[model samples]
Target: TLFVPEGIDDPEIEPGYVERAFATASRMTPFWTEKSRQAHDIQVRSGTFAVTMDGAPIFGPLPGVPGLFVNIGYDGHGVMCSIEGARRLADLMAGDAEHDPKDPFAAERFLDGSNPIPEPMTIHQVQ
Candidate 1:
């Protein structure tokens, strides 16, 4: 989802506060562009970044929760990793895989005050 914030000024966006985050994000950057003046999405603050704890996503049927499943905390690569997440979930449900991939994203890692994830460029190289 797009997840734009309040004070967005794009002509497509009405002049008001964006209360629903998911809806706003849905309308954000339908595609990429190099020019800000031509952008339809509004910028809240520049040079901002998101932090996800160091972990893989929590995918597949959750442990000890009968029939319950989850696919969350995908970090910034959700778009790139969604297929993997779906495959993993499917495998677990179909009895093809033995366990969740890792511990960092186990849904319980954030319980004990771990460091927040850093921004994309700061965390890893793209090319």
Candidate 2:
């Protein structure tokens, strides 16, 4: 996966960029040979999205709103984490489990004087 920097204009599904990435990737590992890269069919898709102020997800109720809850900001790993996130958010909303307002993943973290220092965006820091 390419870590396109934040301010650059969006290429918006540029095939040349994808091909170049595959070419570079092929050179990095024996498993991704030139022929293998060429043979693999590639499909491209695109979207606009937002990441959170801090990298971690925001889960649980919206502050001061009794019936609303939010479970967002998974960065790019929403598919991997959404099941547990939804379960935990449901537990909070259903009152089936104790809900901690100060829980690390809680939305209140941004407002309750508990916001953590934002981490640098790096490949090693992902997840």
Q: Each candidate: what lDDT?
A: 0.57, 0.73
- Model 2 deviation from native, Cα RMSD in Å: 6.6
lDDT of 2 by residue, 1-127 (tens): 3587654554467658676766787879767675654665666656644456677788888889888889888877788888899999888878898778778887877885654666465232424
Candidate 1 clashes between residue pairs 3 or more apart in a chain or in different chains: 2-25, 3-25, 51-117, 52-117
TM-score of each: 0.45, 0.69
Highest lDDT: give the candidate number.
2
Model 1 bad stretches (over 4 Å) = 1-34, 37-52, 100-105, 108-127
Name the weakest run of 10 consecutive residues (lDDT summed) in model 2: 118-127
In angstroms, how far off is 90's CA in candidate 1?
0.4
